[model samples]
Target: MAATRLWIAAAHDPAHRNGGWAFVRAGAGGETLGRAGGDRRTTRARMALAGLLAALEDLPPGEALAVVAPRPDALVLHTLLKPPAEPPAADADLRAALAKALGATTPATRTWTLAVGDPAGPTPAAFAAAWADLASDKAKAGGAFVHSIPRPNLAKVQGL
Candidate 1:
């Protein structure tokens, strides 16, 4: 099964119609497929033409699409992407791991990071569930939703 990672970076304005969305599709290995698009549908068509869309469409069961939208908390996101240790099972371990990963974003997000990373707090059963609430907020809709619209609000917590 193939996995698709799309970064739909567009001009900051929705009404501006800047024309052509710059897309970066991460596929097999480190191979990438980038294309220009006048609109969402056209961008998707280009992806299909490149065969990345078809690869994702044929993904096997249990291998669902993983979609992420850009968050307004640029600083926080910057922190999240920073180098972090390997994920650990315990919340306490996760906290330490996130501190390394998210601490760089901002001092404020650092506090929140420790809060959820606490093993005694909400005992998240898995990595995906740990930031489930935040993921929904970041996407501005449930994960089941096919697409998301960027918004000003950001999820208070994020899972690494």
Candidate 2:
């Protein structure tokens, strides 16, 4: 069975509401999905609350809630490698690079820049570590958010 976890992956810009809350059913072996994008008229609170419910509905039959989207306790990972450059010459190459360096399909933080990328250059080690760290943080945020509110309340809570 996959180890479930959750997290809210936000962009560096506060104005951009393109971020989403991630939910991993089980470590590297499980599925990774999330509720992304928000409209100006809708507050993140509502999106999150609704997203939580939507995500829950996908849980496998007879499965117990093992993790929430907003929580204090979560896994922690260090930067291990730099992410592949943006607009990689070839998509296959990018996948191969990430697979070789991080050994994971998806990164906790989407995109190379957010996960691990610098104009100067990001090492493979740094990228890998950053992704690992984000994985734990995202799961905790989702877990904690759910813990505080069993159901979607449309109540905006900080740090989620």
TM-score of each: 0.26, 0.30
Model 2 misplacement above 4 A: 1-3, 8-22, 27-29, 68-160
- Worst lDDT run of 10 residues, candidate 2, spans 71-80
- lDDT against the true structure, per candidate, is 0.29, 0.31
Candidate 1 similarity to native, TM-score: 0.26
Q: Candidate 1 lDDT (Cα, whole model)?
A: 0.29
State the lDDT of candidate 1 residue by residue for 1-160, as single tens digits: 4444443322122343222223333443544433332322222222112222222333333332333322322222233344346533333433343343333334434221111222223221122222222323332322122222222211221232
Model 2 over residues 22-132: C-alpha lDDT tens digits? Answer: 232232344344333222222233333333344445444333233332221111011212433452233343234433333245443222111212212233222222332
Best by lDDT: 2
Could you report the Cα RMSD, in angstroms, for every candidate shown? 18.8, 17.0
